[model samples]
Target: MSCIPLTQKSSDFLISSLSQVNPFNDTSSIIKWIEYKNNQRFEVNKIPLSKIENWYFEETTGNLRHQSGKFFSIEGIRVETNAGPIKQWSQPIINQPEIGVLGILTKKFNGILYFLMQAKMEPGNINKVQLSPTVQATKSNYSRVHKGKVTKYLEYFLDKSKSWVLLDQLQSEQGGRFLRKRNRNIIIEVPSNEDVPVYEDYCWLTLGQIKNLLQYDNIVNMDTRTVISCIYYNCNGNDRYDIDRVNECIHYSPLIEDSPSGYYLDILKSAMKKDEGLSGMDDIRSWSTNLKTKYYLDVNSIPLREVEKWRHDEFNIYHEDGTFFRVIGASIDTDKREVGSWCQPLIEQIESGVVGFITKKINGILHFLVQAKVEPGNFDILEMAPTVQCITGSYKNEKPENQPKYLDLFLNPDQSVVRYHALQSEEGGRFYKEQNDYWIIEAGDEFPVEQPENFVWMTLGQITEFVKHNNYVNVEARSLISCIGLI
Candidate 1:
């Protein structure tokens, strides 16, 4: 068979046709066609220019071009050999005595014409030349070398319009398909008859076809991350490791070792049973062990304290004096005590109990000016009135007065003047006037005059009003005494 020279048009046409035929479909038929067409060639070597020339000369001269070429002629006479005329009469003469034959070969088959030319060669010498395959099949087969057998089988299935369900019945026989469980890709493992190892002789099918085969095998859960992790640790660690890639490989095959040791492993082991003859548990365990040793050993060993120290100095929690220092929020300090907006003195005073404000809401407006003492505790207790009555306005000025308002009762529990009036006077601005010293304009004077041990005194007018408003005499009088000057 002769080599067919490819033109740009023909090459484009062939590629387009091949593209239209889905490589994923019916790989078997394609492979069969390749084998059939390849058999027509005498040798597997790619066609060279010399072979084409020889073929062309042979067809034109009615002899293989080499057989009719020139021999060593003496003087001007043509030399004759045991074969016949050493040189064809039609050939042009040259000055060199050992000049070889130059001819062409032409052939026609099924209305297609082919041509080739041979260069000068020594007469009586058998020329060796590389021949390109005339048919497209040989080139296509060569292109599929890396794809492996599983991919080829998958392509066969796809070509036949078969679905993935059919792959279940196709048992992986000797020198048959191999599934890359981690990648969800198929590889063919063909046996070798030569001295070479079995794995080396295996021919690969197309990648697209292998993917189709995986679909048939229901091997869709491949994750890139786990696969990459497996490859990185088990294969060579050449690729960069990242979270996303690791997660992907985990999604598919369980061959990956860096995955969590849990129910996921059990599921993977069960699924792996389908390809039972390929690899054993020991092989997988060893691979996983290697991966762990390479990528994950340090994750569980490093101490938190060491890591923190390495990154930065320790975060101090105590002041120089051993008092606990806390990070107080700016918003809390500003809203609760306007001390935050003032200079350092105001802030220090608030902290030191020299000056403080009670947070209270009046008519739905939050006011932070009410004077109060901050109790020393985990929580600052705002002492407004002694029993915590809501007060109005900023008490910045009144805090220095030291007048015993309602709140003073708690501070000085033994004080005798309980019914003292906190009145805003026309002259003194505000003062606590004892009721006994004021006019006793009582509706009835029979009220007990003896001072109760824990009681604050009330005026006769206040007692009569208390009776008018309350249901019980003792309860109303006591309640009124509690807020004696709060208003």
Candidate 2:
């Protein structure tokens, strides 16, 4: 297969990521627009699980399901995995069998690519509104399962005749909460001369502008981040360009120099340098494959009422010890959604989480420390995850030695080593007020190149390549990588 066309598109994306100036709206203007959307009439309040409209618990299996059985259902899954400390357990998971579309529309303006973003409101959002993908809808919603307004700009994705596909990949969502749920993380480029209509809630933004907003907390939603993370920017794919020549093709705007200690420049350099990684792609793949073979994940469906240690009341169903998350009900009323009013079940975490990635310069090229982790709901037995991905309750009272590998480094990190830190949210559609502390830490010079068997050092290019395929990179890792602010 030829990689020439993809390499050219990758180069264009890199330039857009570096360029700070956008022809349409500045970063501040985008913020003001989001604030405006947030002020619109939207309300969500917690109600009893038994009282949610058009949803009921199955009498036979005790599973929470929608009346029409189109959207999604809350079911119980018994998970037995050898990857983590816990061997077997049961929890409530979102059973959405339908694949969703998390697509971003793009067009070229003055040789720079601008992304179309929407200021959408989810029922469970803490901020009430955030920047979402242009079309974030499940197959059920797009096909009028809910019998509501049609999703705007969905034709470009459904009928490929209208646009050129730049990047498209099927990516997984939260494995812990979702049962092998995947979404189409796609980016399509429309011709410059196409007359695409712009609505009040949607706007065009450069990749640089989007990256700049990622520096803040809960501004860019999880769907947007995951879709953006699938974009691989290595112009040297298929050996099309030599190392020096590839560097020459990369142009960094002066705006990147204004960052603290030139960290943005370092990130840019790391992403563009596709060659000379710490480990070869063959080795990385073999390592992952071996992990997959070594570890085992067996998930079986069970009745929700039969789950162990979980208790249910009229309002919610939660673990007796208050561990990972709880299933509750929400009554939502919003003027902006496809359906004006609806009630559904939401998963509220016991506590906020910490998701971090540690990077180091290996042979003058930056490499991210990725762990091949196995969760119960993973489609495959293994997917590359962040170095530290854990909820507070998972290891709060555990001994320091028993905690996850490299957990203490982030817990008590040096201030200077912290490159990017923000309080980002999970998907607001099914999660309620759930936010996590996302971090990018630069490892000290003393950090060793050798890691555990399950962990490997990979360049950003390598990770991006894996992300292009299905079920290789987990959503948490994708979300963290999307926050790499090049601007």
Candidate 3:
């Protein structure tokens, strides 16, 4: 025989001729043969070759009952598929709903060949497994051989609607088999019409939420220092890179190295102007400073009082025109104090019925002592009755009793001492002693020089001056002889 050089077409013809001679027909018989080989090789006592052969005979001959008992026990065998382990019973049968019969056929049949038959018979209804997007994207990026073999044919199946083509088949070393590219293993395909719009909507909604949070005055007006510190503490050096790259696109610029204070102020002013609804920057700066200080103090186990003192010192930097800023800062400190220290004073006041009162005014604030006193008298002396009194005097005053007193007057500018005296007049008219002599005195006029026991005296003036001068307001003076007791 002459030697003939075989071309590509001739080689294919030869292979086709051999395949026709020993064609892959009768999947059940082939699977039974494979199972027999596996059983012999692995010594798997669970499914003997004899049982598989009988199952093949029953399936091919359409007489299933003969090997029912033997094949029925193999129904639960987990057949490995490219997608995952599918129960043998889950294998679809041609025009048959009996899962048990299908399972027997699967056990005795070549799984790949049976799957092809099922796919052909079911057509559109067969499962179209695919890889996840991440896997698909990765696989799309690079091509690599899997399991020591190159995938040549990229076979796919169309779903019912024919909208998506799923990668369902691949050429393996063994033969043509179901494909499961790792990247494509988890993929789910949706109609392009539905998924594209939904993804866009999700992105829009997410952006909207972020925009709304940024629109708030409190959030937008937050101090740049505090915000920067938080970003640094929370994100570390990563924030610097992010602020430069990501935040820059969003119009959030980082401070320049040599940026003047005026630049920051202008930025703040521009931000406020852009969003009229936002709180003033100065106001928010004060608030943010206090808030940051509080947060640090809370986290570091630092005392709140110490934090407040520091805040107070910071607030004192601004003048009166900066009162708003100062107040915001001080209010935070005061609120913290009230929350922390208010209970002590409340308890003391409830128990003792006497508490120091502090009042605030534009000119200044005042602190006074509240005293509870009782009077003992039978003549119904109004001056000696139990009263709630406010004792105000200079801190230098050692005796509060010697301080000037005013009655029934809410405001007084001057400090003066006055004496009240009464004299027993022979005539019906009222008399008072003056300079060691008895003289007639009117009701509203100043008293004479002499002092009388049966009278009341009161002094009115600035508390500091009265205390410094040792001025005594004779609020009330009654005759010791006329009253049985004095209080």
Top candidate by TM-score: 2
**Model 1 alpha-carbon drift over 4 Å, by segment:** 1-25, 42-206, 210-487
Comparing 1 and 2 by lDDT, which wins? 2
Lowest lDDT sum, 10 consecutive residues, model 3, at: 342-351
Candidate 3 lDDT over residue span 1-487, tens digit each: 1112223212221122112111333323433333343232111111222333323223432222223232111110112222112111111011111111010000101111011111100001011110001111113112331112221111121122422222111100100000111111111123323322211101111111211222221111111101111100101112111223322222332211121133222221221131121223244334334433332110111221222211223212111222111111101011111021100000000011101111111111111111111111111111211112222211123354433232212222122311111221110000001011111111222323222221211111111111111101101111111111000
Model 1, span 236-280: residue lDDT tens: 112222334324544333322234333223222222222131223
Q: Which residue runs does candidate 2 get wrong by more than 4 Å? A: 1-4, 236-243, 252-261, 273-275
Model 2 lDDT tens row, 263-345: 76667566665556878888888989988889989999999988899999988899998788899999999889898998999
For model 2, where is the 10-residue window of minimal lDDT? 252-261
Cα deviation of 127 in candidate 2 (Å)? 0.4
Ranking of predictions according to TM-score: 2, 1, 3
**lDDT over C-alpha atoms for residue 207 of model 2:** 83
lDDT of 3 at 247: 25
TM-score of each: 0.12, 0.95, 0.11
